[model samples]
Target: MRRRPATPLLLSATLVTLAATLALGSTPGAAAPGTQSAGTQSVGAQSSGARLSSTPAGAGTDPDEALAAARTALGLGDGAQSRGPGQPVGEGNEATMALRDLRVALPQLGAEQRREGEALLARPTDGGDDPVGQGYDSRSKKLCSGNVCVHYVTKGADRPDSQKWVRKTLQVMNKVWDFETGTLGYRKPVSDRSLPQGKNGGNGKFDVYLKELSGQRLYGYCAPEYLVKGNKRLANGYCVLDDDFAKAEYGRKPLDTLRVTAAHEFFHAIQFNYDYREDRWLLESTATWVEERFADDVNDNRQYLPVGQVRVPDEPLDIFSTTFGRHYGNWAWWEFLTQKYGGGIVRSVWKQAGQFKGAGRDYSTKALTKVLAAKGGFSRNYARFAAVNNNPAAFYPEGASWPSAARIANLKLSKDATRKSQATTVDHMSAQNVDVTPAAELKDKAWTLRLTLDGPAAATKPMAAVLVQNKKGAWDERLLEFNRKGRARLSVPFSARRVDAVTVSLVNTSTSFDCWEDQAYSCAGIADHDAAPFEVTAKVFKDK
Candidate 1:
């Protein structure tokens, strides 16, 4: 059985939300192009192809244009009706349109749920020609190709900071899109600012329009304070506003929470861009997965496809803090999938969803299960993804090494050791050992044994157990989970009497790791008995 490749251990760097801290001073990070620095601020918040044969002609154009056409053709544009007409403003009309489109795509809602979504669209009222909540510019009409758009009210528009802010935010969005779909295609810029909505509360759905209003809401929620305390309606991203911390200008700082918040919102954008029609679990889990992985991949002071803009880790397990329950669990799931099945599986799943028969919400776990099964049965590959998603911190730890048992220093074995029956056999990625059996017969005495592993330690499951066979043909076995260093030890106290010679054999079991997508097989042993054996010299004590 071939051993799975050791998972790369990288640092965990998460983005944290900084409440109350405003964007007043010229901080290290750039601000939105034209907006004045407020002391603090708030922030917030896809699909599919068809049975190709069932679609009308010219359906295969650029996905972006195809998406726009599909939405418009589906009468989604005409669906933007706000609930109760609570307010009217510069981009309120557009907000209403967005609300309508959301209803069409996300249609299975009770009255209250529908109203909740609708209320978000109506919060921005115009303040005498300039809308207070809508982030739109009345005078100019620009076309941002693939991203969401909103118009700016001149008096309320932060024009100077527009380019700086929009580009930065969009770059983040692109990273998410590429990661999720495994496609690196570019979406057009935000030609119209109205693409995103205002912060009327409820999952940053409203916060998406923060640029329009000069006044920023606390975390941009219509009721940021109330929602912070266990409000299920706003539970997903509400933790950012919990009693834990609150500093208005924090969003503008170089903090992990803030970056994660951005990553969270970018996750939503990716869903919209692709035809991802899933629930909070899939959506949130994917975001958490992407945020940490990207942060690790782009460590500070590294030059790759892009330079700079990388985040650093504050502690060993900071990534775990970004989530609770299944959010972190899902991160592990994704990691396992990516590592074992290859990153391509994730991308295939995302694109495949667009062709799913039902609406996004109807695409449930059962559906995905069937899809995965059809492609290939789920096994250790899925497990690896789960492990990574559940405990992202495990991947990167401070002052840790690629654990290897070969690095151990001593070697000794029982006097009974012989060529046909040795103490142990060693195999690893770095090297293989065979034929290290003792030639001389052992005297009846105790033995202290130590052997060094040749490679890094790996965390795997259903590991093979080492077997020992006595000269008389009786055999005993023990399974093991090697530590960071690939090494294990055992002492035999037979006084070289009961045991004549001990032959070490390796056994394979199709064990599973928490982060593997499917069960994997280990490679066959590379060496016969070259593995170093021990000559026992110490008494074997049952109690430690």
Candidate 2:
């Protein structure tokens, strides 16, 4: 959301992230039984990373955007880098690219922030003699499992309180590897042969570093250690988690907090092996969703729903807010997807967005649309998704614990004549819900609430759904029709004798985009048809 010069890594990043280890191809993530659309065509899914020439040092002026991005990527507390003991920080996985951006711009920053950025981008090394970092030996002790190695300190302020924590962390990561790679069938993380220590944490397994991140308020983070040269830009990656999930900070079982964070952060390490420069929102939402797949009982990701697309329906679904966590909060959308198409849907979307040999390598939503094309179409199903969010408790299997879609207007009627609601606008892939409740006066069976809609041009892709709830609380759902001019009318029973409430859900399903322009919306492009307007009016009368 900050106005800054697009870095070379970012300008072409929306197209091709890192070089591919395998051959290049843009295809859907997983194979399914339906007619798969190619999704939105990427500019160049197989484009070479060699094309990206780093910006000259301080070529541009503003370093704040680059610095904030770097700190978030490193999980160094966006609000404040330092926190009192036990305070919790958020997670971010795009540190490799973010650090690169900041590294190039460090010359422009003030001394304090510049030193912070330098330390973040530096190799994970700490010695008692080292300045500005956890005082530990240069070589962190490690224990390995099937395909991952856990790195930790034996004695230091940053060391885990118990060595048992080290083995437990290893078990947690091994479980993540088994479920993600063995059970769910996602690719494993690439090896960090070029790890600065000359040791790939014992035999090139995915390395996880344990340090006093809890002091800095970080849960965990994954960063690409080395980007291989190829068209897909596949990279070797590493992760760092808090030395301990202190009970005082997270207010939960240390093991429970550890489970979800490991599941969430490890997915980012896997993502780097797929596409190091993939869309930020896709990278985060899917990672957050994977935590549920790996450890459903923890349900820690639920904390983000208040800021998610379902709870904040007026914002575009793919917009990546640097200050806001909507990117991570929208995990529920993928949950909606998995429950609908079965578990393989997320993998299929990732497959479509992959740059691997048989990968679709399409941009984020493009791959999603392609995967959902067979289920009906992205447009239709997405509109239904908006409707589903209208009452997540009714649609999602685990949604009983989740919040419902936000309502823009709450209209109550006792004996209403006619009320024209305010005209509001919604962005693409977002919605607005209006709840009309009977105020216990209109009890006759003849009473009805007549509703009308005036929307933007049909080309803008406006959609509407009506939910009529009876006294028993059962809902009748249907699509409200509209003409080419975006006008429509419908009527539903509103009598207190039989009805409970009527909800009108308005949707904006526009997918038009100007690719590679703004790095805010889906595909890092600008939404071409954003802020489509709609107005609804209601008249309660008797049909005797």
Candidate 3:
């Protein structure tokens, strides 16, 4: 579940700032959900009035003129715009705020404050006999059954309705938990007998709080407790929800929102039993992804697809920022895993991640790669996953996959004289497309295009490929291999007299590095970094 930003409470105000910004008719930076943006468009779909004939209908024409017209028709200008500093771009709304809370606030809290926060998470402030301080009326009831116990505040006409909705949602949550645990083969956290047990006793029952939260856009979140020493195990985590926000957001069918949120937030509780401090991207992405399995009709996670696909498609999945799009967009990675391998693969990743006592952000990726290598390494699977993302609807062919390829806005690149090349950045499990034309001096002559990639040096480097169309309209792909310095230079030889346009794309193949010499032993070392953007340079010159 995503966290809400800390701000002054405004109960009387309409908290539709995020909803309004996400509405269909919003402006460029604030476009509606699933709408295409400038840089993250679909490769299969061409813009209106852009004529990209598959058949070299006019092959052998002057390459310079043809490329220029193609750029103009596609609405690509001189393309001198900077991709900006390596900051996580966000929609500046509740989701972004939630990311900020997790990425910034949680880490910045002092030792005492962090302990207090964790304590608050383990034992939430129950609204009892103090409405103002607790943020809800003192009247409350605990509904316990199966593996869940819902503590809801009963007040006015909303209490009865809230209780009924929560009861029903718990049934769904339990069913999902049972199925996931059975299929994934994960052990439910052993109940902590020393802690104060609820009505159900120390049976490992998770807690849920339904109350009127302070912030209007608070929604819901999961607060997981870490594993401790002695006879105590990891405390069963709790979930807090803003009932009023759920009602306002869902209108006549507010329970639908509550039901999905319950499934999503409760998964976070389950994840805590594994590794509470796992990578934020993996935590949120898997939590968001599980919502679909329990409640497909309530696509609350869909609101974030375009945020990642259209806004920053090049940003990789392992990016360590609070950008709402990048983190939420990570759901696609899990979806791909479930489809290609099976849901068990996801469980294996979590199981492996939980084994590490103080594993950092790279733990999730390392675990994932380790689990996936048996089928094939992360590099191989990542290449296929990246391709599927470009046009998910076409690749998935399933009814429930996150519709990313249908929505991502295509990236446009133009020749840059200042940089002495056309350049752009690509993220992990993602790709970027650049449109290139030969210089005027080399028109009608044979020339060589040198493509260079500069980025982190991993055991398995990212893949770069050049795609060009032949006279028969077929796209021939040329894969670029890297040298020892982690730089890949591909010399694309072409006759300016024949070829008209060329598209070069850089793809992130692996996100984490493994230091283990053998599978039987623990890793000697691990080098994990966020999905940092890498530069791709395209330089054109006369063939020697």
The candidate maximizing lDDT is: 2
TM-score between model 2 and native: 0.82
lDDT of each: 0.28, 0.69, 0.48
**How do these models rank on TM-score, best leading?**
2, 3, 1
- Candidate 3 lDDT, 221-291, residue by residue in tens: 66533222210112235566645434434342565666666666767766655544455566778877887
lDDT, candidate 1, at 504: 24
- What TM-score do all the candidates reach, one by one? 0.36, 0.82, 0.60
Poorest 10 consecutive residues by lDDT, candidate 3: 36-45
Cα lDDT tens digits for candidate 1, 1-544:
0111122111111111222242222213221232111111111111122222222211112223322322332223343333232232211111111222342322233444333333332323222232222313334322232322222223433442444444444344345435533442212111111111222121122123333221222222111111111111111111111111022323223234334444544444444333222333444455555655556532211111011001111111111121123233334345446655555555455444332223222222323444567644432233222222212333433102211111121223434432122234222111111212222344344432232222223342112222233446453444333345545455443323344333222211112212211111011112211222222222222222
User: For each candidate, C-alpha RMSD in Å?
Assistant: 20.3, 8.4, 19.7
Model 3, position 103: C-alpha lDDT score: 22
lDDT of 3 at 81: 21
lDDT for model 3 comes to 0.48
Model 2 agreement with the true structure over 233-273: per-residue lDDT tens digits: 46556777888888776667999999998898888877765
Q: Runs in model 2 with CA error above 4 Å?
A: 1-64, 72-79, 85-119, 126-138, 193-199, 414-416
